[model samples]
Target: MEKTSGWRGTREIWIEAAYQALIESGIDAVKVMPLAERLGLSRTSFYGHFSDRDDLLKALVTLWQSKNTGNLIRQTEAYAETITEALLNVFDLWLLPDLFDSRLEFAVRNWAHTDQDLARMLEDADQVRVEALQAMFFRFGYDPDYARVRADTVYLTQIGYISMIKDRPSEPPGPRLQRMPFYVEVFSGRPVSDAEWARFRARHPVAS
Candidate 1:
């Protein structure tokens, strides 16, 4: 029997490797051999864990959906008690990624196009995310319809922004990562410059 490569470090090893593989290549590129290689194991090891590439992909989608749903909702709540803070939290999720990966986002979205089954899986996961985000918006004082609309837009915007960043010119990337904060500010309607926030504060002094 082939050795099974799994549950290393903190979380499942094969699962983490799947996310890495998604990042390096789109879902189309995540073949069993390459994924096994990335995990520093043989195909026997990979098969021992997953019956095939499709099986592994299904597990990856399930794992990501469960974990990322919480992260997205938590991020939305960080700006709690204020609509702006809560809504901007969605933007924050997009700008700062740790709960999920950019490459995986790209791969699955592309994969959903031609594959009906995968498309259904993504639709269901998206529905859950939308529900979570909508609830956050409602908690922040929006009506159901508005919450639904805004949540969908924000969720989809993540896919759009990742596509832009991924398509950037390959000029070594430079130090342009700093610009992400600015993007967050614009998307979230937050004051990008400290000067702006300070000026607003001066106009409306604190009560205490």
Candidate 2:
């Protein structure tokens, strides 16, 4: 057990360096020798942690998902009761995709050859985020299944917009999320009064 834990330390250090390399140089630039150099270790030591570049890359993707999904889940837990606060938590998570620093998502979109583990991580994150949005919609008095479909659409829209920008999010107000509350209002058969719209934007405000 102690022997295994010690090797994981070296692996984690190399994973962290690869993450930084992905951020600074893009996913394609995250090569083994460069990562080893960045970690101030020899390539021989790198091989001690990972068998090859693809192995290290796969580990880095796992670490990225662990951090990203963990934070989103933590945020949702932090604001479990308040619908507005919960929605805010979702936005906070969505606002930082560029920090992943990999165009690998698009690269893998239609390619069946993509890494299965990374694909599964992305899928699971999407599923949990939709679940959070559906929970918010139900609290606002909408049907849960209907809300899940709407939430799915809203998530797709956010992904499209984020892909277009591809940098620090200059997140706009609630209109940036038009279809989200629109899904709530229309699905619940409620009219969105100007006063209520004002309240939503004022209460949410992109970020605090």
Candidate 3:
């Protein structure tokens, strides 16, 4: 078996440093020397984890896909009895990226503008997300065509937020939470109950 202590720690440090640089500036700033400086390590340390700059970039993309798309797929596949519950399950994924790196999301998207291969990967990732949503709706007995459109609406709107660079509010889980019921209802083709909203609010508590 491969050893896991020191090498894993070192690789994670480099990945985290690169992630920070990618989000704060852009992919251009995610160089070995700069990242090593940020981590207070030697440039040679990067070589221990990665073959070169391209290798590091590929790692970043793999990290992103695993966190973002992977979790969304898992959530979409989860059980939900009501349309409200089903919608909430997927909506929760959208509201907070928890394990997903939203900043890295924007960074990679910006990077894709010039990279045909990255753009293609992004397109495939997007299809996967939409299909997952469509599957969720389909499981709820929604028409396939309608489910696809709803999926498109939800996915495209979220992407729009990143592409437009909309300024997120400082205090959240309030305004955003309040509007979620309407979104669920619109997409699921079912009315959300007051009790449902109350439950959602209770689950995602914010200070008054």
Residue-pair clashes per prediction, in order, are 1, 0, 0
TM-score, cand. 3 vs. native = 0.89
lDDT, model 1, position 167: 76
Residue 187 displacement in candidate 2 (angstroms): 11
Query: What lDDT tens digits, residue by residue, belong to model 1 across residues 93-146?
Result: 543456655656677777788789878877877787888878876785677987
Mind sharing the TM-score for model 1?
Answer: 0.66
Candidate 2 lDDT (Cα, 0 to 1): 0.59
Q: Give a tens-digit lDDT track for model 3, residues 1-208.
A: 2544453337887888888898888888989888877876776678888999999999999998998999888888878777788777777775576845567788999889878999999999999999998898888888999989988987888787666553654435567777888888777778887777677677678643
Model 3: number of clashes? Answer: 0
TM-score per prediction, in order, is 0.66, 0.60, 0.89
Candidate 2 lDDT tens digits, 1-208: 2444234346767777776666555667679777766655678888887889989877765665666555655655554344444454555555345433224344333222355765676787778866866666676666778778767765676667646655666657445566555643443445555554555566446642
Which residue runs does candidate 3 get wrong by more than 4 Å?
1-9, 166-171
**Runs in model 2 with CA error above 4 Å?**
1-10, 24-26, 94-117, 167-208
Best lDDT among the predictions, by candidate number: 3
